[model samples]
Target: MATIASQVVLHPTVSQSLKYGSTTLGRDKAYRAIQYFARFYAWYLLSKGDKDAAARWNALKTHLGTARKLLRLGKPMEHLQAALRACLSTGPAVEQVTTIARQISYFGYLTFDAFVWANSIKFWTLNPETSTRVAKISNRFWFAGILFSIVNGVTKSVRLARETKKLQSTQKWGEKTLAAEAERETRLSVLLAAQENTRHQLIIDLLDAWIPATALGITNLNEGALGIFGLITSLIAAQKQWEAVNGKK
Candidate 1:
């Protein structure tokens, strides 16, 4: 019983985020981590002797499972947040518990964005030395895109941690402080939008204008395919951001 409780406390979902060094393989690992979190959370609940509490946890787990399925279905972040809210409503009704789950979920989202941008860079940077000027320029843009994404992810995670600390210290939230935090979050949102737009513009310039105008036009099939891939990925990302800003699912 003690061992089981220790395992519950030490589960990756309770505290784990992808590190910076191995981001190239992050997508696969993130998927595994999500799966493991779900499995362990399930096992933990089953190990509980309190039937009532286990029932509540089971319901929360169901919501989490729905969230995972919705994510796989390409649903927007709002849907995921809704599922998270359902889980939160079920139990452990503590602010600290809420903050940890919310932050970890956001971290997962950022990890995915990082994965896509990293792949974009990899594809763009292939054969960089022998690539045409257009390809080279696109690679630079991809680098900026990935860099901004990493910064955004890290900063948001840090902000969450700081807020959690403040919540713990205060032991309660005040309206004035909540308002200030909301405003700060809004500013961060604007920064994210600006950086994303800049990256999108660079991608458009490369794919629509620069590539066509360059004398060495798409020297190989692979480069063309990768460029198209990057464009699609960027467009999808931009669309999701727009949806988020508009408060849509």
Candidate 2:
């Protein structure tokens, strides 16, 4: 029993989890999953006429959201730096432009969101109308960022498809002049991996876009649907973060 306890305490999974949760992004993703779950559960409770239970879950969701906003206080600068880096990186023109635009939009969103957080905490109060306007602006920027991301993903996917087709055709050449078979295979593998990543990101962006869209009054999805979408995207992001923390490919 002592050995089993020791083994459990020293487990690699436990260590990996600690490492993952140590990062702000990782913790935020975890909290986001719970927040959205609470949102959905609250909606469910309300539908069943359990106002008391629903209010509790709704309060949990709201509190987690406020905490997350606090956690993101320093993120605007990160996005600004990312936008600068994207400007310098070399890629297809469409990709380069969209990446930079997306980063800049996120920078704007986070900057405005910081003010919203401040208002929530009574650090400084905006008039009610002004606060609502600020929140809407933040949502608009977030929506734009996600839209840019979707555009980038679609463009990249198309380009990757073309490259993949060309590579496959070259492989069918009768002579061995087509690059070494091993090298060709390696390239194909890389392209396929990239395509997969792009598709995964596109799906995430599409689901997340609805969140800000609804907030901005561009969509009318209910809290339950929005909660489910947010939860799905958060889990997908968390899975990637977990794999990164654990050094898994």
Candidate 3:
């Protein structure tokens, strides 16, 4: 039993999980997954007339949200740095423009969100009206950021598709061009991989957009639906982060 326990403690998966969870983003994503799950389960319980249980889950969700806010206290500056970097990076014009816009929007959102967190913790006080205004502004910026991301993804997908088609049409018969063909194949593979990544990010952004839309009163989706959407996106993001941390493809 001791040997078995030692083996479990020394497991590669366990070590990888520890590494992943060590990052602030990883911890926030884990908490977000739980928070959204709690939201959904609370709604489910309430629908089943389990008010007491629902309240417990609701409290858990709220606390997790507060914790995540605290965890992200310094993230606004990170977004600002990202925006600056985006502004300097060269890419397709549409992509570069949208990337800069998206990063700036996120910087705005997170900056306002820091205020919201402060208000929540009574670090500073804002009147009810002011608080509501700030929250709405943050949500609007978040919505705009997601919109820009979707546009960037769509534009990139189209460009990638065109490149892929052009590459496929370059093949010729009975030529001593093995090296050329091999290079073309490698380029095509990279394009396809990029296309897949763009599609995945598009789906995640699409799902996440609804959250801010509902907050902005543009959508009337219930907590249950929003919770499920958040949970899905969080899991997808977490999976990507896990792969990155583990150096896996």
Q: TM-score winner among the candidates?
A: 3
- Which runs of model 3 end up more than 4 angstroms from their true locations? 173-179
Residue-by-residue lDDT tens digits, candidate 1, 66-121: 44433443323553575466565643234334434444444444444333433434
Model 2 lDDT per residue over 11-123, tens place: 98888899999998899999999999999999999999999999999999999999999999999999899989988889999999999999999999999999999999999
Model 2 alpha-carbon miss at residue 240, Å = 0.5
TM-score of 1: 0.24
Q: Please state every model's RMSD to the true fold in angstroms.
A: 21.1, 1.8, 1.6
Q: Which of 1 and 2 is the better model by TM-score?
A: 2
lDDT of 3 at 225: 97
lDDT value, residue 56 of candidate 3: 100
RMSD of 1: 21.1
- Candidate 1: regions farther than 4 A off: 1-131, 172-246
Residue 226 in model 2: shift from native, Å?
Answer: 0.3
**Clash number for each model:** 0, 0, 0
Question: TM-score for every candidate vs. truth?
Answer: 0.24, 0.94, 0.94
